[model samples]
Each structure stands twice: as structure tokens, then as C-alpha cells.
Target: MKQVTPFLMFEGKAEEAMTFYCETIPDSSVLDVTRYGSGEGGPEGTVKLARVSISGLEVMVYNSPVHHAFTFTPSVSLYVDCSTEAELNGIVEALAKDGKFLMPLDNYGFSRRFAWLNDRFGVSWQINLA
Candidate 1:
């Protein structure tokens, strides 16, 4: 309970998505990664747990062994406040590839521009230009 970190559960792409986020976002990094051992429920070398940061916002991710009927939804989303349109747009473009956009980038009056989507790994995100 030291901190409330956002946790993402990927079916089998936790490591790949973590690496993508680290590379796509500025000032972001992967703090740690722990993988399942050989013959474990998960494939060897698959991420058991991983800690990563985007814009210094620390988040957790892991691969789940059990299948579920549910997945990420726009109802709950990670909201990012960007300093510039370029910053917001850059992230939106990278994330938009192979991702579904809940709301395409537009001036929603509340913000200069905004885009909401569930990223390639099925994590919801809402980016806004302040």
C-alpha cells in the first residue's frame, strides 16, 4: 500500500507492450522485469511481473495465466496531461496504430485537443493538451 500503481494484465504480451511504452514515451523507462521460470504455468521468459514508467508515472504490468471474458474498457482509463500538442499528438499516433480510438483527436472545448483509446495491448488511455 506504499503507492497505488496502475496494473495492466496482458494475455501474453506484457513484456512486448512494456518495451513499446518505454520506447514510445519520452522520459519513460522500465524499472524492473521478473519472468516465469522454465516449465512454469507461463512460457519461459514471459513476464511474470514488470514495472515501467511513462512520463515518470510508474505503472505495473504482467501476463495472466488464466483467461477472462472481460478486458480493458474506456470506462476506466489512464489520463495523461501533456504540456504541448506535439507531445499529445506524438503519443496518440503511436498508440493509434492497431488500437481502437474511443474519441479521435479533437478540440473538446475542455482541452485544446484530446484523444482517447485502448492501446495495442488493450490498455485504455486518454491524452489531453493543457
Candidate 2:
């Protein structure tokens, strides 16, 4: 009720994902991080919790101690509004590496250029040029 933010659950790749995202996106960075220590629920040095600002959007990242059968799905995705075509192209290329694309980059009628894909971390993203 107070506030709402997107939460990303990763098996053990939370830190990697955060770093990748911060590096790939402009004006993005890791705001804070809490790592697991000895005797903690998760593996030592792993990301117990992390807050990252991706292109001005604050998101929560966690390394879940328990593994599940499910993972990130295309139904829910991080939508990006790009300022330039070059930015869109760069982001799409970086995210699409070792990942699957649900919608390839093109003028999809709704936008000048757009692309929907799951990053290597399995997180879905929709990049658009407005």
C-alpha cells in the first residue's frame, strides 16, 4: 500500500543480472546490495537482496535460497522507452545475446521501433523507440 516495485527472483544469478543490467542501460546503477554470509539462508557472498536503478526505475533483485520449477516469463516484462534508434539497437543486441526474442526489432505499427526479448538471465524486456 505504501509503495510498489518490481521484484526479480533469481536462483543464483541476481548479482550477475544486476551488473549486466547496470552496465547495459544508461543512467543505471546498483543502489544497494546485501549479501548472504556464513550460516545465512543463502550461500555465502551471494546476493541476499539488492536494489538497482535501471534507467530511473527502481527494482529489487534477490537470490532465492530455494530453487523452483518456474522462472521469468514473457507475460511480465520491463518496458523501456528509448530516446534514439542507436540506443534501442545497442540494448537489443546486448540483451538478445544468448537469449530468445519474442518480437524482433521492427516498426511494429504501435511504435517506430520495438523489440521484445528475454535476456540471458531469462528476464523479459520490451524495448521501444518513441
Leading candidate by lDDT: 2
TM-score per candidate, chains pooled? 0.94, 0.97
Q: Candidate 1: give the clashing pairs.
A: none
lDDT of 1 by residue, 1-130 (tens): 5889988888988888998888878899999999999878898888999999988899999899878898887888888888888888899999999999998999889887999999987888999987
Q: Write the per-residue lDDT of candidate 2 for residues 3-63, one digit (tens) a residue.
A: 8999999999999999999999999999999999999989998899999999999999999
What is candidate 1's local distance difference test score? 0.88
For candidate 2, the 10 contiguous residues with the lowest summed lDDT are 103-112
Question: Model 1, residue 66: what's the lDDT?
Answer: 78
Q: Which stretches of candidate 2 lie over 4 Å from their true place?
A: none
- Give the C-alpha miss distance for residue 71 in model 2, angstroms: 0.4
